[model samples]
Target: MKVLAIASAGGHWIQLLRLMPAFEQHEIIFASTRQSFSETVSSYKFYAVPDANRWNKFKLIYMGAAISRLVLAVKPDIVVTTGAAPGLMGLLAGKLFGAKTIWVDSIANVEKLSLSGRLALLFADRTYTQWEGLATPKVHYHGNVLS
Candidate 1:
């Protein structure tokens, strides 16, 4: 099974990297925003997407397009993400392209989700919360792999 691992940057990227072992046997693709590690991540099959924040319409549209292209190209069997806006876009695109999706809310979102997590819940085939307290029908209580 092919897998696409996605995140934003900084902490989320570190978290996604930790989960890499889970899908090592599969074809892997990585994506995140352009950050200091941009060049580093490029060593793998990585993609650049716009980073969406509280309010960034242009970045959001660019990210959506980038995700569409990446999804079509990689054609992953599954998509997994650690929260942030870009990851949410990937999850949506993955589902649209007929891939199973997994969304892991960042440890930073223990008490409440970031905006991306909200969007993820609507599209992710399985949504996970690092904190047990945040567990809901749509969220599983998974301990933080990033921690």
Candidate 2:
């Protein structure tokens, strides 16, 4: 199976990497905001998308377009992300391109779902929260990556 795994920098990226073992035996491509991250997953395909946050409309549009292009090119069977805004964009792109999408919310949001997480629940095929307390009927709790 071909899988596209994406995330923003820092904690989101780290959590995404920790899920790699589950994707063993598949062709996995990595995407992130930092070109420097290509070194982290040197064995697999990698692409860099422009970084953007909710507050920046122009950069957000640019980032979303870049992610859409990447999704169309990869045509992955599944798209998975540990997110900030970029990863949510990835899920939306993947969904539009006929891929199953999964979003794993960053473990840092302890008290509530992050803003992106709330939006992701509407689109992602499967949504996960690292904290059990955050799980709802639609969202799931499967422990955490950061320990």
Candidate 3:
């Protein structure tokens, strides 16, 4: 299986890195905004898309175009993400291109759902929540991400 692991830099990237073991036998690629993330995960191709806040309309359009290109190029079997704008782009792009998508709500969102998590719920094939109490029809009790 070809898996596309997506996240923003910092903690989101760190959390995504932990899932690397789950797909060791399969081909994997990564997508994030930071160049250091690409350097750190050099074994696979790393894609970068714009990281726009809700205010930046132009950047959002740019990111959407990047997402389209990414889906066409990778054609992954599965798309996985840790919450953040860039990660959300990957999840949506993967779904548009016919990949099974799994989204992990950021560990930072202990009690509340982040913006990305809410968006993920609309399209993700499966959405995992690390916090035990955030029950919702879109969420799965996956236990703590660090555990």
Candidate 4:
């Protein structure tokens, strides 16, 4: 399997890395907003994308375009993320191109699914919340990366 594992910086990136073992059997491609993160996954492919948020409309568009390009270029069999907006862009792009997509809500969002997670529910093939209580019929809880 070819997996595109992506996230934003900070906690989102950390959580995505924690899921690395799950991709060990496959070819994994990593992506994030920080180019420096390439050092962390030096053995695999890494892409640096623009960072965006709900507050930044123009940057969000750029991020979506960048992510879309990456997905088209890589054509991953699956796209998984612990997200912010960048990861959501990946999920959507992956979906549009026939790749299965997963959205793993961050452990920090204990009370609710993050905004990106909610948006992802519409497109991702599967959606999960780190907190079990947050799981619904559509959102699943299958443990957490932080654990």
TM-score of each: 0.90, 0.98, 0.93, 0.98
Predicted structure 4, TM vs. truth = 0.98
The clash count of every prediction, one per candidate, is: 0, 0, 0, 0
Model 2 reaches what TM-score against the true structure? 0.98
> Candidate 4 residues 89-145, lDDT tens each?
999999999999999999999899998988998889999999989999999999988
What are the clashing pairs of model 2?
none
Give Cα-based local distance difference scores for all models. Answer: 0.84, 0.94, 0.85, 0.95
Candidate 4 error regions (>4 Å): none
Q: Of 1 and 3, which scores higher on lDDT? A: 3
- Please provide, for model 1 over 1-147, each residue's C-alpha lDDT reduced to its tens digit, 9 standing for 90 to 100: 889888888888888888887888888888888656556656678777678765878878987888889889999999999968788888999999999999988888867876778878877899988889989888898587865
On the 0 to 100 scale, the lDDT of residue 30 in model 1 is 86
Order of all candidates by TM-score, from best down to worst? Answer: 2, 4, 3, 1
